[model samples]
Target chain A: MNRRKFLKQSSIISLGLLACPSLSSAFSLGANNDVIIGHNSHKYKVDLTWGNLNPLHTPVNDCHEMIQDSKGRIVLLTNHTKNNVIIYDKSGKLLETWGTDYPGAHGLTLVKENGEDFLLITDYERHQIIKTTIDGKVVFTIEYPAETGKYTTKDDFKPTETAVTENGDIYVTDGYGKQYILHYNHKGELLNFFGGSGTEDGQFLNAHGICYDNRNPQNPSLLVSARELNVLKRFDLQGNFIESFNVPGALICRPVIHKKDIYFAVLRSKSAINSDSGFILIMNENNEVVSCPGATSPSYQNNKLNELYQTVRLFQHPHDVCIDDDENMYVAQWNSGKTYPIKLTRV
Target chain B: MRKFIGIIIAMLVFSSCEKQQKEVTSFLQQGEIKLTNPRITVSNTLIDSFVTLKPEIHMEKLSVGYEENGKTPTEASTKLHTTISATKPGIYKFRAFHPDWKPSEVTSIKLYKKGHIPNKITWKTSANKKYKGQGETTLINNQKASLEFRDIEWVGFDTIAKATVSFNRKTYIKSLTISYLTDPKSWVFPPASVTLYLNDKDTINVTIPALTEKEIVKLDDIKIPIEKEISTIALKVNNVQKLPDWHAGKGLKAWLFMDEWIFN
Candidate 1:
């Protein structure tokens, strides 16, 4: 049949399938019927109704990122000006919500210093990184690094994510604007900057996420996500390129390290951006893909991993995943119709 | 959205045991199992000799079904396992299925046979400056663009686009296939009409149907058959002058994107 006829028939068939209960029931699973996803030992039981709240009261647009606080609270950051930050407990119940000032809130990172929890929120519209207390008190803000001579105006510095070091240093990724990682001391002074937007080995296309990798305390490094290129890049403390991991077919948003594993919220599968193709990826300490929830099983041949793609349509542009103490995953999505985060209880 | 609700209702229908059904329904009501599009990798889309389709199927309970004649892939179609070789030129569609989850949306790729390569092309109307791909060498380069409309291989035009394609010599071209992109979400629609004048004498015209709903980004091919030998061809493609009322940009001119033209 032609394209037009095929589309017409498919819609009719969809209507017919909806009317026939028995035909649709063929998709139902027996034996406990919990929606289990992921591969290997990292499998999880999906909980779609987690963190749901009234949109009129606690509205969210593009639930951008999530982080587990020191007290085990799941703090979600969204661009919705009504409530930019929503704090939820592990049980998916809303504990508190704050911040209408962060209209472009996209990233959330919780850092503990001297027994106090601090939240680093990146606002792309404001073109600055705001450091605030866990209860929404502003501490300080890091504006666009005009001292580095790399930026012409404030609009050229759309910071997407930030990573802080143990010695009170800051690393900010200008992902949306110019793709540079600006390093600063605790005083918010620009020390240096590197990794501009280019095809070079050290540069990036969309340096969307960054995290201070202290996996090996002796030689700590920064793991950055070049989203459009589908690669995780490692840079030393002094802005030196260390190595890169090529993850084909997975547009990873951020690298979240929990225990000996590295978790990434794959933004979209394949090259279609708005196709609602996304999943969760877990990698071992050796950078080997162990499990991909809602995606194909991980496999490698001759040390080169195969391209990973989504198999289950459970996530729509998963931007971040926060692993709780019990290993439950709270996934925050982007462009998912203002829905709340979906939690994955580890089985 | 109905498909998502159907899975929950079906769970209530299939779990025959009362106790097991209760436990299942309670947990499943909070969630629904919606499957993603299965990944299909073709060795090459520009089919010169033969192409291999390798689908990654991990579990035995799941299977990939496909159709070659431009039909939507269903579970009842031919099951694809291991690797399949295709020597002929046609569009191959694939979809994955499992017992407990909704079947995936169909993924397709068109395999075109290598034909006469036109060396030169002259432009009559200009492409949009932002999307002028490689000047005049864009259409005959045989390179495929990604689903993103910003791909450098695609030349975009919002008005009538006219061009003259020239062959190295007087070539006997049986048919000409024009490859274009349709991403309605990006306000890029298929051409309203594509008129081709073969040797300035014979003319063939094709009109694409108006889009009724939202469509996923795709690269489509339309073949216009011309049996006679041809030396030069003039092509005129008209954009959708007015988008339908359902679209957000209703009554506005829609953009037209063309990447490559294959002659066979």
Candidate 2:
């Protein structure tokens, strides 16, 4: 079956997945060296043509995150209900789009299960963590944890993002709720929960994002966003606290690891929280910020990163970054006037 | 003839200027206060519960109760929620004085429920669906999650990020509690100000101070004094578009984040 035809037949377009128009600023490579974004070996070229579809049909709002599945399809998750999940091939052609169950659909994570692909989504509106098939079938649903004695009401269970370990253990970050990280088994039973809202070394304020850190490969842990403190905390997989590294002046939404480097969407640059004062951060395994795309270059004095800020007008409240197999980056923005995802091909 | 014409024009201009000045003065008098020693008056008294005062100012000291000849004024206690009340009602006098300002005349009121003063009101953000999230329900849901700006619970707008909530029908509301986040590292500052509309009619304008990590601000009778039944409520937050003059990313659009619009 052709991918575009599959999308047209799936009720994805007619289902009201409205996307705001594209926010591409007209520029040519010959004019300004394209501003040459990225750091060290992770630099990229801006490719505006990448996953653009006519907004009248497949529209996207707040392209939150993207992931490449085993079939080599680029799957993008958006809050836009027209098509909650937009699947595109490497060439930027719409292969298919599915799902309408997630109105506050956020945090797209793809994992291969015994040669099969599954998608995990955290819905802020529903306050539930939904595990679904790539085709959008609800496989498992994890409601808010009550037995933990942490949450007093349903309103206190806002789940923002999720991460699954190699052995199929899932960690859900209640970044918007009580600011705790819940560890669960493959069947979706809570195994452990840790982290809370505070300014302490391990406590998190606006623990907005989370991910499984496999930098050690042998001893994997979790990297959580203490966004308000402008830092990322590392914790052992069992929910034990480890250490925290500061990205001074960068309210990073998430830490995206590609190969040996980690990238972040600096949600804001100055001390402010949700402004268009954002840029991209690329750092090495040592947690040292190497480059700041669309902002001032990263600098370190005595191992402390200087307070960084946006120097370019490229992005407004960029939320997340997804690195493709070819090291290409897809930048998703929140509150950016409904613009489509921006593609950055590795230079 | 030329001299007479010039005099006539001058007279017209002066008369017009006088009318404009009067209008401007009236507006300032209604909206603002001229600082005196203690220009305080008791607007309303809810018996032994709370007393609403008018002409509240940045004060060095304020004490209110009542006084008699050759007697000291009985000072009422204050609460953090902005309340001051007396156990008994009598000849109530309010004495407020600023160290740097001129002395003010004492404000005295006779207590009477029938016609002595106005009244008071209060509101709270309850867990209910009587108020529905109007546009971009994702950022602010029925469950009241995602009120802040993150990848999870925020909607994008061009300049101002606003969230409208419609009541079940026409409803009365008095108080509101709003939460906001400002991350300077990402260049997200607090909103320039927050404006609220009731029934699309009256407005409550609030300016955000320099915020830290996260803050939940509660507004009621003192800070915001509108106790009316409004059908529709609109909360408009201004995104900080530029950095401060001394910062590096000055004059840039800084994203504003808001959450948890609790109305009582």
Candidate 3:
């Protein structure tokens, strides 16, 4: 036993304290898993060692994103060139692994076109985005659009994410590079671009992630994260600024929408927005945050979110999150000691 | 009237249960916190005065986190170990904070440093044995971060940062490297000038340029190195007097983190 446990046991034995197992266990009743996180409609049971694999051969530099495929297999993307992608089953068992060409594989987006599912993988180091099949076959690749005249060189096109439309058109956010979102048609032709690096409304600082918000089916909009500025700006499909809202105390990454709710991998809290501070945020259909997984419980006073902070240091730079068919969450972190994704099962 | 009172009590109990659930939503369910008696371990006796605290986390950047003042509920506070020196030297029961989801356990630490060898203050703390004293000696470690004792309150003329080093005999010191963590959260703005008094005789004033970044930066601009053999070394700095108006700690003194003096 550790020193603290020994001290407690010794004190109890000396004082003739009787064990109260039944009473102590009654308060911590959490279905199957004793530990519980989140609040309201988003509470979950944490499983830290869910997707841990041996690091001798299959090592990871940064666990970036995870997604559930059409076959219900959980797919994870990492920067480790040894195996950039690892496919797993729902039961946390390693199914298979593939891809070696992606050294800085960061973003993973699943797109279904013509009744066949494909993957869009963004490479930060190579400054390119590749469209591939589930079997790791590259179909087409996109580089920096020289026609846009915004980028001086190919190095300025470090795209981080891509959101595909129903017609195969894609919107790529140059998050780490020029902070612009480039729009492309089905044939990889540049159509328009929006956002630059600034504090202006139309501009963004570290536009890390982007996704299409189809919650309002009649009017679909694009939700992009200005991570450093702690705001999520909404833009029309043609790349026009619509509105922007604040996510207080969240240095957020890409916005992930699962079922009726929206989720975000908060890279850092507003109070301690440093290198190794991060958490997870969950919002209801009304865009009101109902739960913060690794931080303080979400609270709102007069429609404004209270400044959120990390009460539990569970995550270090959480880059992305993937919600499965069973409402479980698989979180991927960046620069968190080369650890794998953690699973949070909904209780 | 009795039935109404009974219903009100039942409603209050349910509301309290819901409140408790919401409070523990952000708490860790899997991890267990065990805090031991705090120790200040110096890795290298000759030049290293680093102190490793309990419940350590990799502290790249620092913000004034929750302090376990013992009375505050554990679920509401964070455990932090900071080193503070009293005005005079004596044995002290420094409070240790160990906070968890449940009640916190405050441990009182008792340790001694090599104090007052003779006419000069001779501090003989080594790597093997740990000392629990503060002042005139900066603490640093490789695993986590510095204790960051300077990041509290809004006070000007905070004059406790005078580091003194005493040697066994006269030793040659041609050059030295001063290591410090230049983090932004704690507003650790590097000092503009460093004054060093060596051997109770000669004094050297080195001017440092303004710091521009948030990451840790070293000062190697001390042009004329220490050319004489000296038995004692005392150092001080002229720091920023006030914080910027745009900062949260506006009009207050900014904090500076300094550590590790390497003799070359």
Candidate 4:
């Protein structure tokens, strides 16, 4: 059918559902249940009640990254149509949106230091790392360096995620097009680059995510998430391999650090959808699974309602995750048929 | 009686002086000509078609004289024309309505002494292709490809001479068209094969199975053709498969080529 006919049919269907409460509730997970969190901290059993954050009216597509700003406001980065980076607040209110300029924004990070918050973003289309202010003002921009001999052709360069150190050193993962971890000094200078596209012990198939670990204040390590390989490889501040572990999920997007716990948002294959429901796996300092919220098996009936209530919880494709200082979890999801960023507060 | 006579003499002198001042003002007003035309036709040749016309009135008092390449004109028509003449190949402005009424739209008469001719057409190849310059054949992987022509004079319906290019081997020609140029509607291509690529180890071998007599055509006019001295034609090879190589080396060196080259 033509676009007009499709739109007309969709509108009619939507209007019909609006008239019927039960039909609308069954079809839409947002309209029926409010943003719910696991309320009881002691038992760790989530009630799934509507939280303060409202549901966004428009459906989100490929939400790759999210971050909470200095003002306790949640900023989501999505691969919206035509390179638009939409920003939404924690209350599910459409705050302000900008950035049609960077069409392939796949990763976003908010770095706060010295009473200032900066937005560090990566564009797969432009194959570059960009630094902007909290309000979307560009502060620094760096393109893929030609010195990295990994690229046989210019088009083979795509930077996925960015992590900034306390001292302002920036690390970008060339995940989509190229497989390399690029590091730059605080002044936007190319300090060094290591790691190429591979499936070896230290190499990467898709170096999808990166983060600066300040857990050891004296010596900080860089955590790189290799999605396709289903492993999180820990590296030294200078890009040296330290250790690697198998992530519980098939497609691991991003890993967040909260206090002494590390949380990763994982997407399950269709076979593992219901039984092994997609959820955030939290690991303690000993690298042991402490909390597994949502579902642990591939049973559809057990996780269906849980998946329906919080689509991000049964995440068909969870792209990125971050933890605020308050220990609240923010997740960016893709292929969930919704556009709003998901927020999960720790019980 | 004597006082009355002195008063009359003083009045006569004052009248004479006022008459002389009025004559001078009239001369200034008559010397200036107000151009009413506003629009000047832009020809392809001239970069600046500004009119140089001087107003008969004072420069500060002139409201219709040429101001910044014929944007503002003065009330004096003669001065406006004179200033317009100073600029070679100028445009003249005429008022569409009276001064008391706001002019609807200014009209201009373009003075084009000679017609302009476009530069000679040139060609360029993809940077990945080894060949460069016109009529040079480059090997491109079999896919949807393009050959660009630049610097050609844009004549609405005029046709340029076509050159015949033939490939020795059977190759699938997906698309033949021009990019970054005007008249997308006039793009044309030759017919070839679709599934040209077969199973190969190093490179996906895409051989043109057969060639048809049908010609491909595309016409788009919204794009402004490039004016560079050189343009490029691209032969694209697509649908390449990566073969399993036991070597530990990185990246595969693939080959795809165009057997013949031509321009018409």
- The digit string of per-residue lDDT tens for model 1 on B95-130 reads 888876878778888888877888778899999999
TM values, all candidates: 0.79, 0.54, 0.62, 0.46
What proportion of the real contacts between chains A and B does each prediction keep?
Answer: 0.31, 0.00, 0.05, 0.00
Question: What is each candidate's DockQ, to 2 decimals?
Answer: 0.17, 0.01, 0.05, 0.01
Predicted candidate 3 versus true structure: per-residue lDDT over A195-261, tens digit per residue: 9899898889999999988988899889999998988899999888998878887998999988778
Backbone clashes in each candidate structure, one number apiece? 1, 39, 1, 79
Docking class of 1: incorrect
C-alpha displacement of A55 in model 2, angstroms?
A: 1.3
lDDT of 4 by residue, A45-134 (tens): 122221122334333457778777888776777666543556555544566666657667788887786899889888887777888888
Candidate 2 lDDT for residue A40: 59
Residue B250, model 1, lDDT: 92
What is the CA-based DockQ of model 1? 0.17
Checking candidate 3 for backbone clashes, the offending pairs are: B50-B140
* Candidate with better lDDT, 1 vs 3: 1
lDDT of prediction 1:
0.85
Which portions of model 1 miss their true places by more than 4 Å?
Answer: A1-32, A272-274, B1-31, B41-54, B68-74, B84-93, B108-175, B183-193, B202-215, B225-231, B237-264
Docking class of 3: incorrect
List of clashing residue pairs for candidate 1: A313-B36
